[model samples]
Target chain A: MNSAALPGFDDILAAAARIAPHAHATPVLRSRSIDAIAGCSLHFKAEPLQRAGAFKFRGACNAVWSLDAATAARGVVTHSSGNHGGALALAARTRSIPCHVVVPENAVAAKIAAIEAYGATVHRCAPTIAAREAACARVQVETGAELVHPYADPRVIAGQGTATLELLNVAGPLDAVVVPVGGGGLASGTAIAAHALAAECQVWGAEPSGAADTFESLRRGEHVTDFVPDTICDGLRGTLGAPGFALLRAHAVKVLTVDDADTVTAMRLLWQRMKLLVEPSSAIALAMVLGHRQRFAGKRVGVILSGGNVDLDALPW
Target chain B: MNSAALPGFDDILAAAARIAPHAHATPVLRSRSIDAIAGCSLHFKAEPLQRAGAFKFRGACNAVWSLDAATAARGVVTHSSGNHGGALALAARTRSIPCHVVVPENAVAAKIAAIEAYGATVHRCAPTIAAREAACARVQVETGAELVHPYADPRVIAGQGTATLELLNVAGPLDAVVVPVGGGGLASGTAIAAHALAAECQVWGAEPSGAADTFESLRRGEHVTDFVPDTICDGLRGTLGAPGFALLRAHAVKVLTVDDADTVTAMRLLWQRMKLLVEPSSAIALAMVLGHRQRFAGKRVGVILSGGNVDLDALPW
Candidate 1:
C-alpha cells in the first residue's frame, strides 16, 4: 500500500459510516485516580468493549462490509491466533458469509472457542507461523476465499483509524496518543488519524521489550524478524507487516519498550485503580507511560485499551 | 429504623438531588450476547465504576453530606471490611472531617490501603463480627465520632437508592431487577426504587448459598444469624442489618442463592463475555440469573454490578 496514495481521513469516515450500524461507539473513560497516580490527565479509549471483544472488530467489520456482494458470496479467510480471527468470524457471520480461520493448535482455547462460536470454520495447524500461513493458503486454494490479512490489508487499516477519529471527537485534543503495537494495525491507524486531525499530536507505539521487533525495525530503518520473544503479552508476539511498517516509517511514530513485569504491574494497577479488565497486551501502552514516566509526565495522554478478552483464571501475574 | 413509617420515594429523590453533584451516574450497559445466552435482555447498571469504586460511595457520600455542620465538625466513624469504609473515608475527606474506620485485622491489604489513601484513620481489631462492632463502639466513646452504620442507616439506604433511580431513567422500565445481598443496602434501596417507579416490576435479592441467612430470615419471618459462611464471596459475609431486613421483608422481595463455584464461573464469564472486571460478590447476581435461568427466561432483567475492587492475582477462581 502506498502511503502518499493510500485512502485518507475520508476513507476512515466512509468506513465508519459503513460499519456504524454493526459496531459500538465505545465510550471514552477518564480516570481521576489514574490521573493522580500518573501526574497527568489520562483519557482511556475503551476498545476492549467493542464487538468481538477488541478493536480488531472495527477493522474486520470494515473489511468484510467493503466487499462487493459477489466477493462476499465467495467468503473470506484469515490467519490469526489473536482477536482478529474472532472479529472477522463475527463480521462474516453478520454478512452471512462462510469464514475460515487458520489457527495454531496452541492458540488460547477461549479465543478459539469464541471464533467457533461466531460460526466460523477453524482449521488447526502446527504451532508455527509458517505452518499457520501454509494452512491459510491451502484453505484459500481449496475454497477460493478472498484473503483478508489482519494488518496488511488497506480496508482493515481504514477501519481501525475510525477508533481514533471517535476518540479525538469525544476526548477533544491531547498532547499525545499511546497505542500498543502487535502487528501495528491499531498504531498505524491511530498515527494516520492523529496526523490528519491534529498534526502536532505525537503518536507513540508501545511494544513488549521481549518482542521489540517493531522498535528495532523503526530504529534500524528496516523490517526486523527471526528473533523469538518470551513476553507474557500473547497478543503482541507478531512482527510488523510490510504495510504497517511502511505506515509507521512514513508517520515517524516513536516506539517505546516495556518488559513483562511492567506489563503485569500495569495490568494489576488498571484492575485496582481504574476498574478495568484488560489483557496484558492492552497493558503495554500503560506500562510504557508508567515505566517511562519522565517522557509523559504532566502531559495530556490518550491510551487505547485495545482489548479485554483475557482468561481471568489464567492471568499471567 | 421504623418499618411502618418508612420514608417515601420523594425522600429518595431528595437524596439523589443532594448527591448528584458528588456521585457518578454510572453507565448502563446492554449485552446482546448475554441476552442470547440467558434467553433474556440484560441491562447492567455498572456501579463498580462509581466514585470510590462501588455503589457504597453513593450512600456514604449522602450520609456524610446529610450531617449537620455541627455533627460533621465533630467527626464520623464506620465499621467495614469492604467498599463502604473507603467510600465514607473519601466522603469525609471532602468535608475536612476526621473519619475513623474500625476494620478487622484480616481485611485485605488493598482495601485498608485505599481507606488510608483517602486520609481516613483505621483502627484494626480481631477478625470477627463482634470484634469489629466493639472497636467501632470504643472509637465512638473515645472520640465522640458520629456512628455511621454500614447498611442499617436510613440515610445510607436512601443514598444507595439513587443508583436504581438512575438505572431506571437510563434503561427505562424493566420486568425485574436483580441485586446482590450482604447487609442489603443496595438490595433494599433497589427494591424501594423499583416499587416506587413501576409497581409491577419484581425485585430479587441474590445471595451466596453459603451465606443465605437472608433467605432463611425471609422464610422464617424474622432476622436470623450465627451461621458461619464459607463462601469465596468475602463481601457478602455480613448478616442483614435491621433496616435492610425490614425493608426487604416489607417489600416482598424474592431471594435466590448461588454456590461459590458458580460465582467464580460467573466472574470469569463476565470478564470474557462482558469485558467487566467485577469481584466475586458482584458476580453473585449474574450467577443467580444464569444458574436459575428458567425464572429469567424471556424477561428484561436488570443487574447491579456492585463493585470491581478485587485482588486479581488471587481471584477466588
Candidate 2:
C-alpha cells in the first residue's frame, strides 16, 4: 500500500453532511433486462438527473458551500466545457455569490446557455486546456474571485463521494461498484465510500479507452502524462487531478477502459431498452461492464450513470 | 348524468392483482425545477418505463391475463400502430400463448422491431384504420385467436386504472391529475381511480390540437368520427374507442388540447431540464399544463408520462 495520508471515509461523510442541503440524493435504478444481458445483477445510480445535469453538481455545490463567508463574498471561479460550469454557477447562485466560468469557445450552445441561465458570467477561451486554465486564472485575479478547481479540490472529492454513499444505502451489499473517471473525483469518492461500507466490495473505475490516462497511471503506479484523448465521451477527456489520483492510488481501484464505439452502443441500448437518455460519459461505464463481461459475470455490481447532458442532435450512432 | 355503468376503483384493484406479476409498478419522479417552471408542485408517474415501453403494458397484461383457459389456449390478437401491439405481444408471451398484431404497412421500423422482439407475428395492412380492423378480423378468423381490443375492452381499461391507483398510493393526495388521451384508456382509467380514491381531486385529459377528436367529442356531448390527424405524436393519433369513450362520459373528465409544436417543445424541455426521455404523446399532457397555466397554478398536480417509445433518429425538434 502507498499509505499516502489522504482523506478517508470520515472526510466523505463530512462532505455528505455539508452537501446534503444543496445536492439531490439521486435514484438507484435496476433493470432485469440489463442484468440478464450483463449476466449480473446491476444497480445503476442515476446522477444524470442530479442538479446542473451531472454528479459534478455534488462536488461543485460542496466546494462552493465550504467557502468561508469572506471568501464567498469575493466570489468563485472555475473552468469547464459544460456540466461543471453550470453546476458551479447554480451553486454560487444558491449562496447569493458571483460565479465566473471560463468556457471553451466551441462548447455546446445549450450548455453555455444553461451556465448563463444560472446567473454566471462566462469568459470564453480558446478550445484548449491551457487556454481554459489561463482564462480561469485571469478571471480570478481580475474579479477577486477564489479559484475553485473542478476536480482538484478535496471538498469537491468529498462531495462527489456522497453519491456513492446514497447508492450503497439503497443498493445494499454489492460485490462491486463501478464509476466513470473523468478527472477522478467521482471514482475516488466512490472508492473511499465503498471501502468504508463494504470492505469486500471491489471498487473499479471505468474510463474511455480513448482517454485511458488513469488506467495507465494505475498500472504504472504513477501518474501518466503522455497521451491526447479523442473520445466521444467529452466529459472524461481530462487527465485525473493530483488529489483525485492520490486518493484512487491509495485505495487501489481497478481501472477498465471502453472504446468509443461501445460507448455509443451502450447509449443506444440505454435509450431504446432502459428508457434512459444518459450521456456518452455515463455510457462508458456500462460499455466497460459489457465489453469485459467475463470478469463481471454473475456478480452483484453497481454502476454510476454520471450524467445525461447529451445534445440530441450530436448523438453518435 | 348518464349513469351507464363503467369499471370503478374495485375493478382497478382486481386488475392490479391480476397483472401484479405481469406489469411493472412504475417509478414516480418529483422535480423542483419543474415546479418552478409550472408554478406548482409536480409529480410525474412514469409509465414510460413500463414493460413493452408504455402504460399500454398494464392494460394489455390484464386483458391477456383475464382470458379464460380455453380462450388463452386459442391465443389473442390486436391491431395497433406500435405500443399496444408490443404490449399485447409481451403479455401473451408471459402466458406462453401466440399473439398476432395487425400493423399498418407504414408503421415505424423501430415499433415493428419491438413487436417482433416480443415474439408476436405481425400481419401488415393498409394505413387506414378500417384496413387495420379488417386485417385483424382476417387474422382472428384464420388463426382462431380471440380479438383483444387495445383500449375498448373493459379489462384493458381496468388494467390502465392501476397506474393511478399506484400513483395515489405513492404520491398521496394531489389537487389534480393530468393524463394524455389517445383512445382514452389511460385518461378514463385515471379518472375512475381518482374519483374512487380522491373524489376532490380533479382529473383532466390532454390531447394534441392536431388530433383533437376526443376534445371535440367531449365538447359536442357525443363521439366524433371521420377526422384525420397529422400530428407528430404518432401514439396519440387513435380515435376514442367505444368502451373508453363510455368510461370518460361516465366520469365527466375535462379535456384540454395543445398544439403539436408545444408538445415537441415540452419534450425538449423535459429532456433538457428533468433528464426524462418521454415521447411526444407523453409531452402533450405537460404542454397542456404549461399552455393553460392558470388552471393548475399553485396546485399539487400529478402527470402520467404514458410512454417513451420514441425513435431517437427522428425526434421532432
**Fnat, one value per model:** 0.78, 0.58
CAPRI-style grade of the A/B interface in model 1: medium
B76-116 per-residue lDDT for model 2 (tens digits): 99998879999999999999999999999998988988899
Per-model C-alpha RMSD? 1.8, 3.2
DockQ of 1: 0.74
Across B106-212, the per-residue lDDT of candidate 1 in tens digits comes to 88898999999999999999988889989999999999898888887888888888888999999899999999999888888998999999999999999999999
TM-score of every model? 0.97, 0.92
Task: Please report the candidate that would top DockQ against the real structure.
Answer: 1
Clashing pairs in 1: none
Clashes of each: 0, 0
Candidate 1, B268: how far from true, in Å? 1.2
- Which runs in model 1 stand beyond 4 Å of their true positions? A1-7, B1-5
